[model samples]
Target: MTGAAPRLRSPPRNGGVRHSPETARKKSPPPPPSSSAGGIWESAHFLKWTAADALRLPVRHPIPCVLAASLLFFMAVEYTLRMIPATSQPFDLGFAATAALHRGLAASPRLNTLLAGLNTVFVGMQTMYILWTWVIEGRPRSTIAALFMFTCRGILGYATQLPLPQGFLGSGADFPVGNVGFFLFFSGHVAASVIASQDMKRLQRCHLARLFDTLNALQILRLLTTRGHYTIDLAAGLAAGVLFDSIAGEYQISHKLNH
Candidate 1:
C-alpha cells in the first residue's frame, strides 16, 4: 500500500491573523432567543433579581429601613383611624399656636385690621423686591421663580379647594383684590417672600434678606392668627418657593446653553 501524504494546514487569509482560544471565546455572543417562553423566563429572572437586590438594601442601609418602617406605621395608623365626618372639620395642631391670637382678633376688630394692613404691606414689599430684581438689578431669576410658583399654586389651589378655616377674620386691606374670592390651599404671600429673600441672599445682600425674612415671619404669624391660611398651606408654600427657584435656575441654564 502507498504511504498516506501528510496533511498540511492552510494559512489565514486576512493578514495571517489568528484568534487565540480565549479571544475567540470572548467575542460578542449571539442575541437571546425570541421565543415567547424564553422572553417570559428572562422577565421572571429579572424580577427575581430586582427583588433580591431591593431586599438587600435594608440590610445595607439601616436608615432606609427605619424610614420605610415609619412610613408603614403611619400608613397603617391612617388606614385604621376613623374617617372625618362629612360635616365636620379636620383638626390641625398648627391652629393651637394661633388660638389665643384668634381669640384676641375675634374680640378686637381694630387690632385685626392693623395686623391685616401690616401683612398687606409685607406683600407689597415682596412684590417690589421681585420686580426690582428684574428691572433694576437685571436679574430675572426671582421673577421667573415667582411666576412659576404662582402658576403652580393656582393650579393646585383650584384643583383641591380647602374650606376657609372657622373664625377666619377678613379685611378689605388684604392682598389680591381684598381676598373677595381666592384659593386657600397655599399662601402666595409666603411663597413670594421666600423667592425675594432667597434672591437677596444670592445677591449677597444679607441684610436685605434678613429683613425680608423677619417680615415674612411676621406675615406668617398674622396669616395663621387670622386663619387666612392653614399651617400646611404655609409649609407647602415655602417648599414651592424653593422648588420653583431651583427650577427657574435650571431653566436659565438650559436657555443659556441653547443660545
Candidate 2:
C-alpha cells in the first residue's frame, strides 16, 4: 500500500493536450515580411517594363498609331479653324470628288435627265430585289430592315430640315414623286440597296451581292454628282442599313426565342 506513493501526473496546459517547446515553435505562424526598398524598386521596375512593352506593341502594330496621329491632327485643325458663318455653306471634301460631274450636270440638262432616268431604274431594281427577298424568296429580314431604316430616317429627316443643295438635279422619274421635295439627310435608295445586298450575302448569293455592291458604288457616285444627297447623308444611309439589318436579325432571334 504505502510502499510506493501513487506516481503523480501533471495536468494538460492550455487545453486537453500539452505540446513540447519545439512543436509549439514549429506550429506558430511566421512574422510578416518587412517592407524593403528593394521590393519597392522591383515593383517600380515591373511597372516600367510593362509600360515599355505596351509602347513597343504599337511600334509593331502601326495602324492604330497612325490612326491616333491622324485623329490628333484633325482635332488640331478643328480647334484652330474659324467657325463657319450661319449663312455660309460649309465646304465638303466628298463634294470635291464629283465637282466636275456637278458642273457637267449644271451645263447639260439633257445629260442630267438621262442620268436621272438611269438612277430611277436603279431605284426600281433595289425595290424589286428587296421585295423579291421577302415576297418570293420567303426571307423577310431585308424588308424588315428597310422598313426600320425608313421609319428612323423619316423621324430624323423631319426633325431637322436641311435646305436643298444649290445645284440638285430634280427628276420626275425619281423615287419621290417628281423629286419635288424629300428628306435630304438620308438616302432611302442607298439604304434599301444595302439591305438587299446584305441579305444576298447572308444567303450565300455572293455573285448577286457583288453585283449589288458594284451598283451601289455607281448609285453613290450618281447621288453625289446629282447632289441627291449630302456626303453625310449617303454615309449615314450605309450605316443605317447595316444597323437596321442587325436590328432585324435580333428581332427575329428574340421572336423565335419567345415562341
Best by TM-score: 2
Return the clash pairs for model 2, or none. Answer: none
Tens digit per residue, CA lDDT, model 2, 107-202? 888877787788788888988988888898788888899889999999999999888876777777666758677998888888988998898888
TM-score, every prediction: 0.78, 0.78
Tell me the spans in candidate 1 whose CA falls farther than 4 Å from its real position.
1-15, 22-73
How many clashing residue pairs, candidate 2?
Answer: 0
The lDDT of each candidate is 0.87, 0.86
Report the error of model 2 at residue 28, Å: 20
lDDT tens per residue, model 1, 1-259: 7999989989986589988888878886977767797677887756666777888888899897999999999999999989889898767667788899889888998888777788878888889989998999898999999999989989999999999988889988777646598888788999998999889888799999999889888888888888888999999988888888999999999999999
